[model samples]
Target: MPNHIDFVATLAPGIFSYELATGGQVILAMDVGTLVKKGSDVLVSTRNAVKAPDLGKLKQVVVQQYDVLDEREKMVRSASAKLEASLIRRFVELK
Candidate 1:
């Protein structure tokens, strides 16, 4: 993922803002929502919620991929530790 600074820089140079329904107070990004910059330093309101068409399916795929990667990492670490222990035991027996 690109750094936040780099990501923002790529966006069209502009200041962004979003108006909440309850009050006139300008809350930060987290409170109000994601701000998108258009052309100039102009603030454009945007929806915070993702607009994925197949969000559920995408999420399931992502979770499955993460599980596979985690299991692979655990297997590699376990094998490495076992090999290290066997090597140490052999060295001690030779002494």
Candidate 2:
């Protein structure tokens, strides 16, 4: 399957948010089979996709991606404790 970034890029511009709502609806409706099918579709579609770079290369890419932000912008975008906590929890669960 494609790496997460590529998969998301290919699917939709806001699939992460969309998926949360869609998946929640599916769960609430008790449609486990549909949810499984959706997951299977993602895996099948991305089975032959290119893999992402290793950690070091990805770090460089992240730096480059954020390089356009000036000091003020960086400050404005500075991490928040609440956001960090949520991200950390997701990261830990995913790992």
* Residues 1-95, model 2: lDDT tens digits: 22333333233211121133245311111101211123324422321112223444444544554465466576666756568889999999998
Off by over 4 Å in 1: 1-53
Q: Which candidate should be chosen as best, given lDDT against the real structure?
A: 1
Residue 75 shift from truth in candidate 2, angstroms: 14
Task: Please provide TM-scores, in order, for all candidate models, with all chains considered together.
Answer: 0.42, 0.25
Please list the residue runs of candidate 2 whose C-alpha ends up more than 4 Å from where it truly belongs after superposition: 1-39, 43-52, 70-95
Candidate 1 per-residue lDDT over residues 1-95, each given as its tens digit? 22233223222322233444585534222113433344434343443222222545445555665588799999999999999999999999999
In terms of TM-score, which candidate is strongest? 1
Screening candidate 2 with a backbone cut-off below 3 angstroms (N, C-alpha, C), the clashing residue pairs are: none
Candidate 1: worst 10 consecutive residues by lDDT? 1-10
Reference-based TM-score, model 2: 0.25
